[model samples]
Target chain A: MWDGILTGLTTAVMPFNLLMVVVGCFAGTFIGMLPGLGPISAVALMIPITYGLDPASGIILMAGVYYGAVFGGSTSSILINAPGCASTVVTAFDGYPMAQQNKAGKALALAAYSSFTGGTIGAIILLFAAPALASVSLSFQSGDYFALMLLGLTAVAAFSGKGQVIKALLMTVFGLMIATVGTDITSGTTRFTFGSVDLIDGVSFLLLAMATFALTEVVMTVMRGQHNEQEPEMDMAALGSMKLSREEVKEVAPTIGRSSVFGFIVGVLPGAGATIASFLAYGLERNLASAKEKLKFGKGALRGLAAPESANNAASTGSFVPLLTLGIPGSGTTAIMLGALIAYGIQPGPRLFMDNPDVFWSVIISMYIGNLVLLILNLPLIPYISRLLAIPRPILIPLILFFSITGVYLVSFNTFDIQMMVLITVIAIFLKLLEFPMAPMLLGFILGGIMEKNLGRALTMTDGSFSFLWDRPLTLTITLIAVFVLLFPLLSAMIGKARTRGAEVAVNEGEG
Target chain B: MSITKDHIGGLVFLCLSVAYGYYAGQIPLLPGDEYEPFNAQSLPSALAIIGGVLSIALLVTADRSVEGRLKLAGYDFWLVAKLLLLVSLFAMALPWMGFTLSTILFLVGGYWLLGVRSIKTLLVASVPFAVVLWFLLSQLLDIYLAPGRFFTLMLGV
Candidate 1:
């Protein structure tokens, strides 16, 4: 493991590789400043560009985007008073008030430091955890794999959004259906191509990815109208010194440490990305705060800024655990990367550790470098980002369109794909209007092929006996977990209602 | 309370599931194969069943709302429609008119449609972008972008 770490650190410092990391972080932060666009969209949209580079360089770029967007999201939350993404929503809770009070520099500095700590800690946990987890997963067979993939899809669906289970599931199944197009390898027959010559190859992953993210985003932007909601006026003069006082650093240090562990744990869970991690960390901190600190939390408490800023960065690193060790992407942003890996022909599973350790380790090491680059960018460059927020809608929207169309064209050079993308974009916009969670759909599509393959293999081994899902202990354990996860929300709701009823009854009896 | 878009969406999906299931059932099996009931058709057919049931549940249990229709007007509907139509048109025309010419036409029309009134900005942004994209992707990356009849005839290739 130490040797692996050393190799990764060495690979990450190469000039070209290092350059890609810096560029990705800068671009991620810049794009994350856009109001409606977030890290997932940033990664998905940039994938075509990455296709032109080597896998390690491409991953280094995406990692930079992931962390950059997280940090940049806070920048938007602090400067403009509008949270750019869900992960940074909590940063705005205290971050905005500080900006209003002219303590913007202090808040930004705290957030940056917390982010660095959280990111470093999370990477450490992943460094130790991933190899161990990968070693364990090396024993996973077809059945175990299928069950894990099943759990991954179900957990993502459940966690995607509340009360939208039906919609998310529908989109998920729809995604799988879309994957059913073109050839079914075992049968040597086409399944759902509808007889078009272009359809023979099924749909390209690039085409669907561009449609769901890039095109849909554009269409939604247009539908959102030219009248974007006005952001709070930002004052350049109010950005105080970009230095953290010794006391301020001392106060947030414990909070950062606590949230780093908390956030990394949440992040390691399938489907719980940085947003959930940050929220969990913040909530835990707030719950434990004394009367003095509690009062100051939403009013610009140092710990308030530290908790989420650190945790989100930590969780961002945590999210990589499943993607590298198990080939299952727990969230939409990671799913985009799974597609990138497949495009490069590097199968991302336990075998990848042994087969492609260099690719995995280099990406891991580049993230540490990316965070350092971000911290440097955060301090001096942060105050100036408010100027970027003033960019006009007309100019920015057209540029987004240019990237979407051209990116799609550059991939396959087929006009049919471009046309198909437009049609899918229309559907995507329709789904967005309906408030269907697109992440589950994306996850489902990525996993659909693999799930089918594993299912076929597992069933073949068992001679089509479904009960063999319980034959192996590992597979059975995974199956149980999947079932438990599906039922958890329902069971929790029932228990909560029951507790409320019991409390009311006890109160009535006492009054009588 | 009354029917919302969920009900409409659910019904749309239900219909699709039924049609997909029907089509999946039509997939012929291999001759003389002694395999279990599960085959190429099995999983898809099962998914179709699951989808159909879920769609029905969505329709039956859809939250109550006054039946509402999606309505768009003025700069809202037509501009979006035109932009959608414009992209579709450009996509279709790209093969015939070529990447360079088609992009120029599309951007000019697209910017105009999106209400970018500055012709100078449109020309500056679209022309330079199209040329550079063509050069970088085609020449540098060794990617093949089809040159349409217009370009071929004009260049006398």
Candidate 2:
């Protein structure tokens, strides 16, 4: 085992490998900085290019784009209050406010430092934990896979915030319904194509993703009218001059350490993703902080920003663990990447390690290098990238549209795809306007194919006994966990209501 | 803006799903002894039922009063309509123009419709982008992008 790891480490240290990591990180940062373009889109857009690369190098480049884009996303969120993706929304809550206060450099620094710390710690944990997790998951039956999908779907309810959960669940169901499009595996029958030749294979996840996340967002922003706000100039001089006190660093250090571990664990669980990991970390940190400290959160609390930043980065890093080891993607970005890997003829199961240790371990090793490069690049270069936000929305929006169209066409060379992109974008706009959450839809689109294949495979394995879900203890445990996750919100709500009623009764008794 | 529109939307989506599910259900099953009885149609049919129920739930839970209808007017329906139209046009023209010219047209018209102020800046910025795209996609990547029909006719493919 050590031999494989050491070999991977040694192979990854070559100059060409190092260059790929740097270039990947560089491109990821720029892509991440662009509005409506997150790591998922960046990776998807670049995956085709990586086809010619050796599997390890290809994976390394893609990994760079993934984590590097994440780091870059924080820049815009902190500087302009525009989150490039959903995971960075929390960062914007406090990050941009600090930037507004002329603490852009400081905010950027903290974000970078925290991201590095969290990412490195997460990588270490992933190095040790992913193999173990994969080994355990290797024994999972189809029922277990179904149970996992159920749990993943339930997260939409958990993380959809204080919004109308019925709406979120409705969207999730709608997403699952959409996922049902294309040929059904068991019957070899088509679903939902309506006689369109383009959809015999079902709605493309890539098309759906680009439409919902990227194009739909563009439409909404355009329809909302060009935002006229000038980009807040980060006081670059002030940014360089200010420093975190040793005492302040000490305070957040433990929080960062704890959140990193928490985030890594959450990320390793398929379907949890970065947003949940960050929120979970923040909730945990707030509970541990003093009352005064807690009050400071969300209102420029360093830990407020630090915890989520660390946790989200860790989660991002940890998500790759499952993708690399088990061939199961933990998030949308990784799923798209799995498609890319397949396109490159690198099958993504346990044999990935045995077939090509260089591919598996080199990609992991590149991540460590990518994070260091990103930290160094971000610490000094943030001010320059923040200028990108100043580009008029008119100019930026068009370019974005151009990129989306071109990127889509380059891969398929099919006009049918362009049509598909537009249709999906239009639908996505309507869904967004109706307050339907897009994340679950994205999750559905990515996971839908996987879910269908596994469902069929499991049924074939079990001869149609629905009890296959509970046949194995592991599958049963996953199902139970999913049940708990699904019920958690309702249970918590009931408890809160009871507590309120009890408080009122106690008050009445005291008055009497 | 009416509660009826919400109901109609839900009804339309649900009906579409059911119709889709029915069609998917019609595919011939493969010869297999060890498959789940649930075929392509099963999950989709289940989803259709789920969609139908949820739409009804949304309909029932919808606010019934006139004030509820008034709230819909505030949601900038014009913007959505324009976006839908633009996307349709882009999708239609993309095949004829290939990626570059088609994208330029879409972006230009989209930005103008969406509200960009300066044409000079738009062109200045957009042309170089077109050039770069040509070089990168056609030259470096070797993707055989379809030429514009008019251009193809003149240039002889």
Q: Which one is best on TM-score?
A: 1
Per-residue CA lDDT of candidate 1, range A1-512, in tens? 78787778877888999988888888888788776778887887789889988888898899998888888889888876667688999999999899878888878888888999999998888888999999999999999999998898878767766657778778888888887778876776778877788887878887888788867776676777843444455676678876887887788889999999999888888888899888888999999999878999999888988999999999889889999999998678998999899999999999988888878899888878888988886556765665666666666676677678777777777778878987888888777766677888888888888898889888888778887689989989999998888777667768998999999999999999
Taking chain A by itself, what TM-score does each prediction score?
Answer: 0.96, 0.88
True contacts kept of each: 0.41, 0.53
User: Candidate 2: lDDT of A340?
Assistant: 70
Q: What residue pairs are clashing in model 1?
A: B2-B64, B2-B65
Candidate 2 CAPRI category: acceptable
> At residue A165, what lDDT does model 2 achieve?
53
Q: Give lDDT tens digits, candidate 2, residues A400-500.
A: 66666656656676668777777777777666655667766666655666777787677767766677788788888878887887677768878998999
Off by over 4 Å in 1: A226-235, A384-386, A500-512, B33-37, B65-75
RMSD of 2: 3.7
